[model samples]
Target: MNDYYGSVPLEEYEQILSNREYWDNISGEWEMCSKMEDKLVRLGTFVQRGGDLNRVIALYAGGREYTYRVTIQHCIERYLEALTNKRVDNLKLRLFKLEKEEAVKLLSEMLKVSIGVDFRYDKYTSRQVSFGVLDTRWLDAEGILTAIEQEHRQAHHDESVEEVRKRAHTWIGDSWW
Candidate 1:
């Protein structure tokens, strides 16, 4: 029912090109967020390795903390754009977005809690929250991967055979394998 050029249909090539363009438009922001996430991982590793708490606090105070939040927020906005443009109507996607927002809120709350503990006074007692605690809460790789898998499954279920074939062709054409 569909025409093919070599291993892929012309229609699929056009679709792939459109997808590439969409990704390219957001690639810069995505790369920036990825780099920031890498730095966050490194920071978490540093704290786990028993790095100096005072120096760590000083580094975070120098803008890393703000940058981390801003980067994450930017990433969330970009993800929302992708989901919206793709017309994704999956409950998992909604749950994933909600989880991300909750993580951000928790991070803010943890920081606020830490401030009171870091500068303890007779009337300002608060529970101490470690950097590792915040890092683990925010960087949930498994949960993200699961959400993505669920979204892809939902997307896949809606695809016609021709659509799936075209997607496979596009993938093979784009990848070395």
Candidate 2:
């Protein structure tokens, strides 16, 4: 199994970029291992990451998919900044835009909070892990969210629909601009 993404220092990314096997070889290059669908099977496919001129990676390293995905969901932006050798919200750009450091202060401050969230669906346990923190959201895909209208789940939490909705509301609201 591979170690978690971001577990290594910045040098590793530079090394990966230099390797011929890991690239999609488009205009610039995309990391073949970073694509989500069919991963290594589509090593040269055009599935995207980064955002603009940037690209992506896809991998098929055995048993590492889960860790890579979870870490990606949390840290892709920062990871892209490193891989592309660009600051996510580059302070220099901000400084130039305003011709001073004052305009960049808030943007700089914004990067300080490092938080991550993941919702893992454990099919074996039939439990839905939400928020990467709370083991909540018992996960009713159908209309039977309540116990009164429920099926037998292998492993489910007893959180009420109202509570789950409230948590969902807070998370969504907090995420909004």
Candidate 3:
């Protein structure tokens, strides 16, 4: 009988060394999670796996090791394209890249799209209730018409400003890494 303490089998040791070497030798910066498929059931935006959507969202969302917070997240494709090469791990560098007047335009557009529109997609714009028991004659024509019209809308709606938000999440997938 023997007590073999702190002993690793040769095969396992070699595998451990191999993994360490591979990870340590990786070039530049890397992350455990990069391209990932996220199900956007609410927006119905299907993100395919192993591309860059995860990275893009991370950058846009900001404050990770790879990059600082972008601060401003709204913009046209052209402005965002400018940031394609702007990679830095500091908040200043990220902000510097987007402090142009055009960036202001980007911010404006982003805010405007989601605002001004009703937050609730109530499916029913109008609700009128008229009930009579003794009179037993519910005379309501407009209410019926409004309900019919509002049938198309949805309640508790979640959406994105397609042009600004979609590109920010999906199109900018390859950058800021």
Candidate 4:
């Protein structure tokens, strides 16, 4: 076994990414590990630190074949790593299976929360006002906004399914614009 706190082999990471089931299982495992770490800390046991980007990537690639929690875990880990450059050392991750109605309700709530600001007409948008917080790929504000402006003009609509993308891009371009 490797002496590193968290080190995943490249081939293992690829295998996990390909196997969804395997991925999900490991996602659950990470979640459990995280929770256990929390408990340990509470009980004065040494806190089990979270995996770094390399570890997450390794796990993701490891279980690429199966449809499992690993996929979501990988995505969440990647998102956090990309955005914060820190491991998930002290966060709680959960997986919930919702009914159709519940899913719709959650979706509706998400839409409302994510698009609460109209970046097109607004002069100042808060960082919390857009989906860029969720996906760090939108860090290039100007580029993202340019793309949004083009898309909006093409669609000739104030809002579309691409609204969040536009807002994120716009915010990226000019936080105070």
Each candidate: what lDDT?
0.33, 0.28, 0.26, 0.31
lDDT of 2 by residue, 71-160 (tens): 321132333233224564542322222211222122222222212345677698798654311111332212221221232222335656
Which segments of model 3 are wrong by more than 4 Å? 1-63, 67-105, 119-177
Q: Give the top-scoring candidate (lDDT).
A: 1
TM-score of 1: 0.20
Scored against the true structure, residue 31 in model 3 reaches a CA lDDT of 23
**How far is 156's C-alpha from truth in model 3 (Å)?**
45
User: Would you list the clashing residue pairs of candidate 1?
Assistant: none
lDDT of 1 by residue, 85-175 (tens): 3322342333333333243333223232222111222344354332222223334343554565566566556656665454334322221
- Quality of model 2 by C-alpha lDDT: 0.28
Per-residue lDDT tens digits of candidate 3, residues 1-177?
Answer: 011111444334333322211121132321242111111110011111112232333323343332222222322232222222232222222333331332333322322222121122334645432211111023232243234324312431343345334333432332332
Off by over 4 Å in 2: 1-30, 35-114, 130-177
The TM-score values for the models, in the order shown, are 0.20, 0.19, 0.17, 0.20
lDDT accuracy of residue 7 in candidate 4: 39
28-59: candidate 4 lDDT, tens digit per residue = 55455434222211111101122122333344
Give the C-alpha miss distance for residue 109 in model 4, angstroms.
28
Model 1: residues with Cα > 4 Å off, grouped in runs: 1-142, 175-177
Clashes of 4: 32
lDDT of 4 at 94: 11
